[model samples]
Target: MALPSRASGGRPSARATDTALTLVVTAVVVAWTVVAMQYEDEPLSSTLVGWALIGVGCGALHFRRRHPVAVAVVTLAVSTVYYPLSAYDGPLMVTFALALYTASAEGRFTAAVALGVITLLAVGFGEAHQTGGNRQIDDTSLFMLAGWLISLVAIGRAQRTRTAYLHEVEQRALAAEREQEARARESATEERLRIARELHDVLGHSISLINVQSSAALHKLGKKPEPSAALTTAEEALEAVKATSKDALRELRATLGVLRQADEAAPTAPTSGLDRLDELVERARSTGIEVRTRTEGTPRPLPPPLDLAAYRIVQESLTNVTRHAQAQSALVTIAFTDADIRVRIDDDGRGSADEQAVGSGIRGMAERAKAFGGELTAENTADGFRVSARLPLTTIGGTQG
Candidate 1:
């Protein structure tokens, strides 16, 4: 299996700096060893042995980041031995510095505290023994130990701060990504609903017109001596379909265009309703289907959505009869009562009484009716198919039934 890739958009890995740091550390150790060797008042062999042990301790520095605690322990052990053998000086101090850095980076607080106390005690004990309890201890060892402890604490604090900062950044980035996804999904759902509404509005009217006009054209073709007038009526129906299609397309583009531009003007055209039903029927009659309309009860004003729902139920029922019922005549009935508005469309045609699964047209009409706190039912009778829808007349704010 392949290795997993590293995360994007952060500092380079610690491994990236390994080679440079190792070379720099090696150079520093070698330079300090050479200076220490120059001041030695001993045989070359003894001095060479001492420098070799220091070199080994410095070489261990390369592994500090990968295993900081282990490197610190090894370096401390080597330094303890070197200090007693040779007087505490440059090479030993360099090893101690490396150990201090390792301990700060990786060792626990308890380990650092223990190391600090032991180092100070060792220095004090060595000083006391050399002076035979008569001379004052030098301040240099205390200062060195103090500096090493401070460096360890500073490195640990810096590491903690860096970790907290990185965690905060990651959380903010994750939240931003989730917010963007939610907005995108909401926008998509709105666009889909808008398109559905527009299609229902535009096509519903035109299809109703085509059904009425086509039946008229067929009837007129059978009675007239010449077929030209019948042909003209058919042509007019087709033209109306084309015109309605174009209008629907225009409205769809308008709504979707607003969504595409972040700073576009708000939409202007509101949804259509039942007041336009006369023009809808006239357009159908122009196409040749014979459409008869009847209205009963008081013509009380209704909410926009319920009105639109009532109009659509009639419209879809007529369109279905024309398309699949093989019907020449259709009837539309509207009744307004105290509590609800009722709509019924009936047609006398072959195959109208057959029961089949509901198609998208019927489903769309049902959805419109149900959206307004209403219900719809379609059934076949002895003579033809009948569609009835009941919508509550009561107004409910912000509800689109």
Candidate 2:
């Protein structure tokens, strides 16, 4: 984000500006010294010495950034000597003022102030006496010089303070950007894990059934030949495998589509939301488990991700009920409040809570609810086992359902 130096325009380069400033001050001081000398009865040698002193003082400014206080002292000493010895007056104080400004701007405020005070005192003393009838300074000029010096110091200090403030603001902006990027990376990592869990829940159940059915068919074929019965068993197993594999492929495609970039293509299949609750119920019913579902409040639209989470939690709970709970019938109740949606599945099964508590399906269900800033718990009730979940509506834009 740092800009190129050339972007600041031609003369903003500090070294180049300093060099130019030295040239200008040299010209101005030489001109003033020449004009003043024309009115005085001073010797040619004295004029040469005055010009040499101006060159030395103005030349020192080039190193002001590196040695501001030293440069200021050198310029001050040159001006103090040049005014008294020379039989003419010049604007030599220009070089000294520039040095004082540089010193204050470079964070040498105390030294610049002390030097300014010393120069003012020297001028005050010079005003009370004459330097070889030259009358180099007076009371009015001393006050004016003091005011100019104070203004230069103030301007330089203000510049330094402004620069410091700007630097602090830029640093804070960079820190905020870095923090935001870290949060984005963490969010991406969490999303990948959630997708992996969804894939497992989608394909695990049907694949397990295929494994069981195929194993049974193999065991039956190993028995003494009974042609018609064996053929019927083999046909049913193959059919079941075909249906299961087809469902797995469909869900797999849907899950994988979520990973694709936005510009490529969108998913062709619909996302699984609470609208597909009937399909889930039918699938569970085919497993010979009577599942009765009822909604306790008004059914409305919900955020797609939230809806999918709710559906997944219910689907996983029913999966556990059918797989582990040897219950005759189960009831799935969905009650909606203004703040959240609650899902409770109760089954009259003899399944032990301690055994089923450690299952991955339960953990996945809990994770799904938690993704929506909600909670889930599976415990045994008086009659049977119960799986409960509460999915919040406030987060991810309070969409009601």
Candidate 3:
């Protein structure tokens, strides 16, 4: 059979180790054979044939790792014939034992077992038929030999099983690493989207109001160029613009602090939450859109993420009212209960019913609500457009009672 590329030359260190081992086996076998012959009066031709068989048997082991079954068979055949024909019975069975071990370690257990059985039977039968004054193979010798072969096979099988188990563990570790990397990438994407939503809510509301006030100021000043009246209107519009711009810049800076590296300073300004709902309402009212806000039930402190999500949902909803629903007035109702908080915004404007389905502002609000295990619904009501959200209240753990 053809050898795999890995078995032939994958590891240089393994090749070197195997070469040294083969040399050692060859030396031990040759030395034992020479010593045994010193006591036996064997003929020159018989000794020469024994030496040739020893050379072939030991040399075949060089490719044992690559072709374990073939080597095991060759060595077994050589050893079986050598004991019967050679006068000097040296340690020729050692080479066959090593080959059997290699076969078992290489995952050729069935072949190794078959070769071992054949070797035992052939050697036993040959010893039974011999009549010369040679060293006899007794029952104890056969039992000892069987014990040695079984031990080698057991040890080799254990090594094979250990190697397989280690390989499976490494594969499991690699799979876990890949899953962790995928989760990390998903988290990064969600963070980017969150930052984008924050920027939009912060900047969009202020800029839209600024544009409306500026346009109104210019129109009033142009229609009636009376210095007394136009200057006063211009002054009020500019003041509103200045205040809105400053708030926008502060919030923008705070939101962007999340993008800074770990070593850099974070923005110290407190995050906007329910405490700043009045400020948000005032800003929306500045654009001549009457914003009425009311609270129901008792007010309580909320977890930071839940509070932030609640505030953003309201802010984005009001911003949408100013930009899309040309309504003159809107009502925001916040209701706090023992288990959850609800916020509802209703505007009496002729806005498109499909706006809530397609608008990014509405989508961002829904995402925020979902992140907190809450729910949001935006739909056209009999009066106009309505956006409502209900967020559960709990401790730091994201569970709702």
Q: Distance (Å) between predicted and true CA of 396, model 3?
A: 6.4
Where does candidate 1 have its weakest 10-residue lDDT segment? 351-360
Candidate 3, which ten residues in sequence have the lowest lDDT sum? 1-10
The best-first sequence of candidates by lDDT reads 3, 2, 1
Would you give me the overall lDDT of model 1? 0.65
Q: All candidates' lDDT scores?
A: 0.65, 0.79, 0.83
Report the CA-based lDDT of candidate 2 relative to the real structure.
Answer: 0.79
lDDT of 3 by residue, 321-361 (tens): 87788899999999999989999999998887576445638
So what's the TM-score on candidate 3?
0.81
Error of 2 at 273 (Å): 2.6
Q: CA RMSD for every model?
A: 5.7, 6.0, 4.5
The Cα RMSD of model 1 versus the native structure comes to 5.7
Clash count, predicted structure 2: 0
lDDT of 1 at 327: 71
Q: Which residue ranges in model 3 land beyond 4 Å of their true spot?
A: 1-67, 82-95, 136-144, 221-224, 264-266, 356-358, 394-401
Which has the better lDDT: candidate 2, or candidate 3? 3
